[model samples]
Target: LLQERQLIYDFMYKHKKTYSVGKICKYLKVSRNSYYHWKSVKLAKKKDSRRTVLVNEIKRIFKNSRQTYGSPRIQAELEKLGYKISRAYVARLIKAENIRFKPKKRFVNTTYSKHDYKIEKNTLDRQFKVEQLGKVWVSDITYIRVNDKWIYLTTMIDLADRQVVGWSLSKDMTYENTVLKAWNTARKRRQIIH
Candidate 1:
């Protein structure tokens, strides 16, 4: 149907100056009003095509950013690419495309609070202010991801001067490998005066 309409419209366009529009529509067995309406809708579709192009560009930028950019950053990138798009419009487009940004992982919790093991009492009782050099020591274990594997890091710090007394890195989170290794290093570095 569209192809036939297009052919009739093209024929009318090519001979518009030579022939009348009513005579052409009558001979083509189509209404003049339908041709006029299709012409107007075709003009409107040109604007819609521009929007489609912008949507494609936005999707490309979003993917290139690893889907980690929000509207403000996306708008900045678009501006750098010579696209003068507003942040709100970019946000709307992102929402429409269902693009979700993944937040950077800052801290990974390795502690299991619901464990069945015994919980140690807080001996220091939040009194971090230590006067003597070897009065108090604090230790913590953290995990780091490298090459799709998690490695454990244990660090022992002297609370008095806030200095790292010892540290250990292990492929596993075993107590002997992590805490004991760091503790041994600290004992070797300085005497256990406390």
Candidate 2:
């Protein structure tokens, strides 16, 4: 029992990232039945530690502020009280405590693809090359599936060496947002052009 508990702790300490019960069992070289039994035993034996107390206090402050205090702010506040804690520790505590700050949930589309603004013709026209640097550029938007959520990423690439010049990420996929990213990337790279 002690060995199994130590194995579970070691596995979690080493992995850091989330793991499934099956993964835990596989990593610890134990059967699923044994892993679950040990997990329940360990959970039952668990007691509130000093870290838990500090985290609870942090959560109280976060909640009292209406969930506006993120990790950095919370860490700063704790430091003011003479608590020597790292931002990473605060972030992990927040996640473990399931304390979430209110995130900006409004999805605003700033892209005006249907507007009357002049559209620049595709200068590269699939000829993705340049004799000199920054002559041709290509950009695209892609979405990543993180858990059950979708994260949108827009990136501009220089055709000269297929290098990423700029990138932006958001929870919303807007045409204007993508175009602006590409334009900004080109503007920044203007000095690099021949």
Candidate 3:
């Protein structure tokens, strides 16, 4: 990502009359700190990487904080070490070094069970027995994680046989993708209607 910033800066430099660093940075979502960092890196080609020292300091502070400190807290620790640094720079360092902390699980309720819509009563009356194979089918929906994204799964199972009659997997849980498809497939397969 930083290398792309350099390439953009080089282009902006050649077209100085048409573009400024601020405009380029805004357009490319590149921070001014990164621009200055690239500049310092270029000017100090004769010397060793300056950020290597800062990176090491950041690592020490981060480790001392039990890896729970974000950029703001890390910057405070750096200040104690006589290094005046920006939190954004600290964030860049942490991102570049792949420093991370495990986040606690957060529960997000996705159900709308208490809404004002008309809800059906328990017609089955908690009874699981069904005389016919295709007469009574129960369905449920759930979401699965796939590469940081959620995909929904809906399954319809015959209560009498306790076997899955039909299933549908989709990226969303809308009616078209969720219970509708599964119900349609099960109905067609069983050739039965309620």
Against the true structure, whose TM-score is highest? 1
Once superposed on the true structure, which residue ranges of model 2 sit more than 4 Å away at CA?
1-123, 189-194
Q: Write the per-residue lDDT of candidate 3 for residues 1-194, one digit (tens) a residue.
A: 65766787677667757877788778878777877776777668734466888889888887776666888888888889898789898899899999995553487897768789988889889899998988889999987877568899999999988989888999987999999999988988888887
lDDT of 2 by residue, 113-161 (tens): 9888889987667775576667766777777867559887888777777
Q: Best candidate, lDDT-wise? A: 1
Compute the lDDT of residue 113 as modeled in candidate 1.
98
lDDT of 1 at 142: 80
Clash count for each candidate, listed in order shown: 0, 1, 0
lDDT of 2 at 120: 91
CA lDDT, every model vs. true structure: 0.85, 0.75, 0.83
* Candidate 1 residue runs with Cα over 4 Å from true position: 1-66, 70-72, 80-82, 87-110, 114-116, 143-151
For model 1, residues 80-134, the per-residue Cα lDDT tens digits are 9898889999888888878889876677565679988998998999999988877
State the TM-score for model 2.
0.34
Among all windows of 10 consecutive residues in model 3, the one with the lowest summed lDDT is 41-50
